[model samples]
Target: MTTTFADLTTMRVGGPIGRLYVPTTIPEAVDLLQRVAATADPLLVMGGGSNLVVGDVGWDGTVIKMATSEFDIDGELLTAAAGVEWDRVVAAAVDAGLAGLEALSGIPGLVGGTPVQNVGAFGTVTSDVLHSLSVYDRQTGQVERWTPDRCGFGSHRQSVFKHSDRWVVLEVTYRLRRGGQSGPIEYAELASRLGIAPGGTAAPSDVREAVLALRRGRAMVLDPDDHDTWSVGSFFINPVLPEVPDSARGCPRYPDVKGVKLTAAWLIERAGFPRGYGTEWGDGTVALSSRHTLAVTNRGGATTSEIMKFAAHIRAGVEARFGIRLNPECDLVNCSF
Candidate 1:
């Protein structure tokens, strides 16, 4: 009766875990990490498990579950423990008449995971409002505070914390506006939904509501009863290229500091792997989310192997059709397709 990763992760598909530890305090988490680091076994520090896909072979070492959930608000400055649910932070900020976080509402995962992925939605990202963060640097066995510049924030979900185990985010501080209005709405879809022009502003509460509704419509929000939400919100990162290739003519493109960012969903659908494409592949256990082409869902009783297999098919198909390889946005644990 060992607990498996299926019980912990949103995807609900990984194999049995060897060991698990839930640290209720930052000090306790650091002590556990030190102990684990002394051993030869592998280590995984998990938050909400919303962005992970583990192999069927399972983890053979230690898994640290961040469980601390304390937060403080000093006027317009909000600081939250790494384990706090991300949506709760947004809701609290809006209730306090603070702006900046409203546009990022409804994103699943913990506060600590936000910096790791630079989580964003609507028209805002975590780095946009981040002031500083406290981290337990395992390499030095010391706690340190780092500014946004030190975090190496980049385009399309890039951050220094991603795919690295050297730092454990303990708390994050966000500087928000005192006024009740949100930042300028730069995303066209969100502006249209709010009945405003792009770059216009709205009440933080209204923006939060609109964001949550949009996420729910796409099955991006977690709902236990909905198979479509039983997956990471997006399986692939939108490829950023120097120039739009001829094969991707007419595909939606956006400007990025590095180059141009192409829509992953557009490439996926055009490659013939439309929404709900894998229903006929393997006993119907896994498929693209019916509401979103970018989400690969566990329909019911799907294995991690099945999920990876389906994802590989989509990646391969897209590459074959467009000569561009799509990379996974989710962190693959002890697994690769």
Candidate 2:
């Protein structure tokens, strides 16, 4: 029996796949990749199946589930292989009395995926700590290190590797501080939860706990028993606009270099799609997570098409109500909404 994406992804929905490779070592992974690169069929060097949505029919190509787990700490510099669980790295940093990665405590997926989305929560972004990365080029068969500038991290989420599938991330190096103190708190909710003023710094362990608690409350952290946690994190990225439109006057927005980053969860809720919105909303298969509107969850036995339809409904509603198109944060694989 072929193990499909349904067996791999956190959402637990997808069809049969021909093969999914989980290499025991980096050399093995590279060897398989070299072989796959010679073929015309699609090549997906996937990490943790967090930010993915495959079609019900499934992918017609090879799926490389990144399995490397090499992580080392030299002074304050933390280097993690592509396959290391993201949260574990955060926990390790906190245990080692490192800072800067505290606010990003509960984020799912692998270290390799961070640069792709510039994953951020509270206020600290991955790029803020990212020093460099190593990637294997399928076209050139050369493994090279990339500086942050070459990655081209954009607002909300976008990178040079994000749109293109040519470069396969091998490992990532993040520059962290050896000091036990946390960075300045930038997210108001997090600061309030921690009983600290905005811009105030706390212990990394305290910040980690606070962040994890906040995530758990929203069901953003993975919980096998909770259906709400069976989601690909936030579905739509907060749309970074050129400027806030006059029509969206009351919408919560933050100023950025791109223009304005409007809160997508707020937009969805305001557009009339609230938390636990489903059943009567769609085919009853997919729904807005009971704990968070940002998560498009599989209620039970939901199909890819059902989820897409439900998302489309939400997107349409938001666009009609606010005149802003919501872009999905979940990376589409052999599927579209």
Superposed Cα RMSD, model 1: 1.1
lDDT of 2 by residue, 1-337 (tens): 8898877887878887766889866787789889888887788777888898889999888889998888999998999999899999999988988887988998989888999888888888888999999999987998888999989886668788888988988899999999867989978899999899999989999999999999999999988888898889999998999988887888898887799999899889998888999857656778889999899998778888888888898999999998999988988887788
Task: In candidate 1, list every pair of residues with a backbone clash.
Answer: none
The lowest-lDDT stretch of 10 consecutive residues in candidate 2 is 279-288
| Position 167, candidate 2: lDDT | 91
Q: Best candidate per lDDT, number?
A: 1
Model 2 TM-score is 0.97
What overall lDDT goes with each candidate model?
0.91, 0.87
Model 2: CA > 4 A from native = none
TM-score, model 1 to reference: 0.97
User: Given candidate 2, what's the lDDT at residue 6?
Assistant: 76
Our model 2 lands, by Cα RMSD against the true structure, at 1.1
